[model samples]
Each structure stands twice: as C-alpha cells, then as structure tokens.
Target: MRQTGAVDPTLPPGWPAAVRPPGAPDWEHTAVAWLFDLVPPDYRAHEVLRRYPVLLARFARDHVAAGLEAARAGWRTVRVELADDLPADAMEAAITAYEREGARLASAARGVEAVAGALRGERWVPRL
Candidate 1:
C-alpha cells in the first residue's frame, strides 16, 4: 500500500499515503505532514482541524522562509570558511542544492496556500 507524508509509512503501520502533487520529492512532500503531526493532539483536534487550511498556509510559509534564511546563512558561512580556497565544484553543487530545495519549499508553501484557499471555499483543489 502507498503511504503519504512524513509520517513514515515504513515506520508506522496503516499510515495513509501522503496526498501531494505529482513529481514532488518525497522529502519535501512529507515535510508538511510531519509538521502537521508536530502539533499537540488537543490543538489539532480543536483548533487546527477547524482551520487547517489557514494554519497550514501560515505554517508552510514560515517554514519555507526559515529554510531559505538558513540556507543563505550556511552558504555565507561556507564562503567565509573557504574564501579563495573554495572548490569550484563544491560551491556549484551547494548553489544547485540550495536552488532545488528553495523551489521545493516554495512549492510546498503554494500547496498550503491552495489548501487554505479550498478551506475558504475558493474552489481550488490540489490534484491527487
């Protein structure tokens, strides 16, 4: 059976397959679900479930922004540490990774927005 999200289908039995857009990487797609699970059960039951879309959008946007900031900081650190000795290939690889991860994070944020819009009765629905 296919499983969904960061809940680790392999780690737990009966975890539902994470619903996500086609071609989304497993890591990025699963991150949202992992975040959802991080909320306290009581809050999820009472507050999150009722306003999941809005909450999710906020959560995703914050997460992506934080990640981008961290990545930028890390890149700066790498540059400072290596200075003129920096390996061109390694720097290129780091840049590529940062770009890819950024795109993934932006996509996830968009997904959250779409969910929020749907919850607001906006007719948008993510393709399963």
Candidate 2:
C-alpha cells in the first residue's frame, strides 16, 4: 500500500480514533484492527478478513447495526414481557441499559460506516 501524509485532526463525527484517516501511514492496518475489535474473537480466525479489509468493514457495519436493532427491540418489549417477573426498579434499570446500549451501537454503526468508506479509499476533507 502507498503511504500518505499525516493524519487529519478534524475527523468527522463517529470516526474512530483507532483508525488513522485514509492514506496515512499504516492507516489500513489500524483500520483493520479497529474493525476486528467490533467483531467476535472467532472472526479473527478468518484469513479473508485479514487479507481484505473492505470485507471486514462490511461485517462490522452489519454486526453493529444488528446490535442496535436488538437493543431497540428489547427496549420496546421489556416492559410488557417482563413486567410480571421483574420488579419495577429492575425493569427501569433494564430499560435504561437498553437505551444506553442502543445509543452506543448507533454511534458504532456510524463509526463502522466511516471506516468502511475509508477502507474503500475515500478521504475526508476539512471544511473552512
């Protein structure tokens, strides 16, 4: 891979700090590492993902989006489904956990998208 200049400080929202902006030195390596962090440890066994970073980005994006969806679904159904078994305070805590997880996954989704774009050779330019 070709090496580029220094990293841009003005990264867009949801851009992961672990990944250098596209074209920076060893940026692809860092991007691959960050993408692997989002996936299951078992995924590390896959040589294809290691060889091809763009595919890893796609997998991370889908995984994060699924997690966000699962969090939303749990948040919607927790009250009705578990109200009988769980105490009110426990239920409240569960809801709060789901909300927090949902927000985190949403941000992860954006981050994965940005990383995927970068892996595909997209560059970020700062505005005036």
Best candidate per lDDT, number? 2
lDDT of 2 by residue, 7-78 (tens): 445665678767876767888898899899998899999999999999999889888888899999999999
Compose the digit string of candidate 1's lDDT tens values, residues 5-124. Answer: 444322222222444432345533453454465344454455564445456546655766687677767656766676677688987787778777766655555555544443344543
Structural similarity to truth (TM-score) of each candidate:
0.49, 0.87
Candidate 2: misplaced stretches above 4 Å? 1-9
Query: What local distance difference test score does each model get?
Result: 0.52, 0.84
Model 1 has an lDDT value of 0.52
Give the top-scoring candidate (TM-score). 2
